[model samples]
Target: MNLKYLIFIIILITGITLAEETKQKAVLVTGASSGIGLKVTEYLIKSGFYVYAGARKEEDLKRLDAMKNTTSVRLDVTVQSDIDAAVKFVQSQNRGLFGIVNNAGVGVFGKMSEVPDKDILWIHDVNVMGPHRVNRAFIPLLKESMGRTTIIGSISGYVTSAESGAYSMSKFAVEAYTESLADDLRETGIHVGIVDPGAYKSKIRAKVTMFNLTGSYDLNQELTEEQKKVLNAAKERNNKLKEPDEVAEAVIHLMTSDKPKLRYMVAPTIGAAEVTMKTTLGRVVQLNADQQFEYTRDELVAFLDELLKENSSEL
Candidate 1:
């Protein structure tokens, strides 16, 4: 080849390498097939971070693969082998793993008394231990990068719903686990946080009302007239709810911040859950004079930060 052609080839290769190097940090987003997880993946890619998008479905993988610089992972957080495979895939990529969004979760609607043991067991496996599973598998990678970790939580973590017993139980467990994990990793360079979101237009809505996947305790069981009323109310309310962009922004902030709060309450409403948190945190924790019961995401996060700090210390 002539010198001019060789120079042109070198420039092309150099430009490609530069572009690749710009996305040096890769973040793993679980349950990335839809809803908040999908939105988070998109935001991260647009923000110029390489994303390892995890999904249990083939269609989700295909969609994520079409995006530039994203690795589509076949993952079911409850399954050990899937977690192992995802870790291996990230290893193959040779990119610096900067974070993991433990966003995979599901909800069920039933009274605590009526729900079967197996139902709660299955849920605990997914919502409670799932984050643990992902963390355990990705610890080495997270350690290498001193990465940040964010747990996608719910208002139910602190405030129980009248009908969603199994889901509330699991989320409460996740609440404790997130705090413990953060405390354990405090000394390490890695940062750990949680975002407890209220009603958001996500799969959780349909999962509870429509799909009803909780085998023994699901819709197959007959509902009381009261239960049906509650179901209808929830359906109506959730249907009218819009997807909370603030929730996604909150997660992204937690993942990317130089110094992130331990937890955030992503409720854009004066939710009943917020009321419970207010009372509990007020009694047990310090109060910020500027804080009040509110719908603003920033105020809620501030309120939660104080409460989570108290929880961590007690832990």
Candidate 2:
């Protein structure tokens, strides 16, 4: 073949491949700056996805911009303008969004009495409303591709406890919204899933602690000895952060599978989802029709007792 003709053919093939990539495979990840979201973006790009790595900070998106087959986008899940810009980027590609990882969230740590309502609202704004905003903006594109949406929920949502009220409340709301969103979108051929992580290494725990320390809570307030012990334990547990790869892997699975699971338990430690999956609560979670997922205090305490025994036996 002539050198000129060979070069033309080569260019043509390259264009075709790029076009297919733009047309058939595109995913957007919010809060792609760090932690699980960053890993998910990286994993998807390596797996041949046309990834839109959405980060609020330009500095954080630098690595993603430097990568091939990836577009760095400004997306603050709480900001409508950012969501709009992201939608426009996807539209310009002419490829509908194939998947969305609504991975933006924040943490607030304090006892119920010490955590202010304003703090709780702030956490809810990001953890709960943020996903809703992103989902609302991207529904059209997602529908066009018949794509899937993965909301980053938490094990905290199901197993509420002390010193995590502010964070847990937001996740509880997210859990309900995720379920309702899934039910509403099911008939439209759009799939939604929730990944409730237990524990892993991330900046979130540190953030929670920092917020707690810097917060205006009355340190002069007296506390029972038991309260102080519980408080310290919460801080210590959060400080033990682990790698976020497991959560990223779960997100990838949700994005790639033809029929993704509605709930994925991707945690570094054993959690309510894992324990429940093998016990009676699992049946309740899988089979419940109503919005209310409830357990009496006594029942939950007993369940935890048995769960601990089971875990100890495994060791």
Candidate 3:
């Protein structure tokens, strides 16, 4: 054989070996019933990785189970027993878990004053503690694989909108906790990262609005008709969000890359928001710290006058 041909054959063999190594890797994705989690699971499976998709509903699990190269396990991140069962299912697969995508969480939108304590606690349970429970349950498996565990957080993790305080608080907690976890696991060869996506077209916004806020309250009596209109406008803005697949693609990129980043802001909107929050406007707002006092000082007259003026300019 020619020497050139022999060298070519050797390079081809090395490439094949690397591809095989990548194919053997497996991943577990939580909250696979719908939205971003479901889409991410589908993308991973299509890329030829063994995927364990977890959902609280068996019907949804069965739907994902029907897909090729995928398995579904019943998992409610809020429950430890369910998490244990999910871990056991992955262990039984015999592929050795390569990644854990903590994608299960919910959103809540309401003023902290209007939202009940019970609702706030529920948000924290599902959004913050849920990921913590799953990470704890699957850390050993992730460590065994010696790869990475990607946490699917949100843009709210870094910035808070007016009505989404509860949800934002939960995501902020997730961000801090995961960052600390990443540092702690750096030496162990098990990487940790966060995917903070902006608004995605998902059931989350509608579901949160429907479930977290209901019934007539005495607080509503105090709220003027104009205040109600402003609240509805905010909800409408959220309804016009982007698709979940955008977020799924980002998750897949983070998972498959050789050198993953510690955090990824999923879309341009999030990137823009982050930039704005770091700019002069954010600094000015923080420095003043008297918007609330100024508004209440004159029955929100100045606030409403400025708001109407902006609306007129837009029109």
Candidate 4:
């Protein structure tokens, strides 16, 4: 080869090598249109990671795509075709996937005995099965990269309320799913975790209420006095809730940390944390109430102390 041509080739090869080395690890965040999902996406991009922000609405997709270091994917977690296309799009980018944040979920509130079966199924489809579908579709990519996957669970998984039976059931199912997934991938060098967020400012309640009353998230339709009261209560609670930045921080840690935890409860207040832990302990007491092989109080306390020490060491 001529001297000048050889030098040009060297420069081209060097450029390609640098590009490969400097490429940012990409993370897929479903339901990135708003709330916790959007917060997680923003945090990842700002932390110098690439984000494939998934949103169902075209306008939301445009907004996400406009953000720095983001490629908005039109992913409807409930839709298999959308998920398939999203997987293909990520593959075409040639940036191997590093993590997935299953954040797309819906809420439902009503007496379990009277709530329509369709409504219950709808909540499950999005809140429970959505993560299942997305994770299954992307597990191959995750395995190739030895990446992490985290589900956006809720404190509701630990404490079920009277009117939130459907929603709580879905979240509880997510807890089980995450644990099972972690076990399945334990030896594959792929980490799995769950982030359970307490009440935070978000449109989930509004969406669920409106959809349940009007068959869609449309407020144009007139609501009954009782329904109006429900909406007002949600608004009041939202006004007092904090932003989900802390939840996003936990997600970032799970993705980047050397020893990521299996469960993270991102409660806004200490009271919230206490309530969840108490509820979990209450369940243990209930299970032991009439059991033949129940542990004594001292034994249970010892077990808890040991687990706490183990967890603190990991941190």
Best by lDDT: 4
Off by over 4 Å in 4: 1-22, 218-233
| Error of model 4, residue 280, in angstroms | 0.2
Collision pairs in model 1 = none
Q: Write the per-residue lDDT of candidate 1 for residues 175-291, one digit (tens) a residue.
A: 888889888988878888888888777656645664453233233456668767766776677778767677778877877777677778887687646675774566444444445
Least well predicted 10-residue stretch by lDDT in candidate 3: 212-221
Q: How far out, in Å, is residue 133 in model 2?
A: 0.6
Badly placed stretches (over 4 Å) of model 2 are 1-11, 215-240, 271-315
Q: What TM value does model 1 have?
A: 0.80
Give the Å shift of residue 111 in candidate 2. Answer: 1.2
Q: Write the per-residue lDDT of candidate 4 for residues 1-315, one digit (tens) a residue.
A: 899999999999999987964578999999999999999999998888999999988889999999998999999899999999999999998898999999998887888788789888988999889999999999999999999999999999998877889999999999999999999999989999999999999888777767766677654578899988887787677778899999999998999898899999999999999999999999999988878998999999999999999989988
> lDDT for model 2, on a 0 to 1 scale?
0.79
Report the C-alpha displacement of residue 8, candidate 3, in angstroms.
Answer: 32
TM-score of each: 0.80, 0.77, 0.73, 0.91
Instruction: Give Cα distance to truth, residue 197, candidate 3, Å.
Output: 0.6
- lDDT (C-alpha) at residue 128 in model 3: 84
Cα misplacement distance, residue 311 of candidate 3 (Å): 41
User: What is residue 130's positional error in candidate 4, in angstroms?
Assistant: 0.8
Q: What is the lDDT of residue 105 in candidate 1?
A: 84
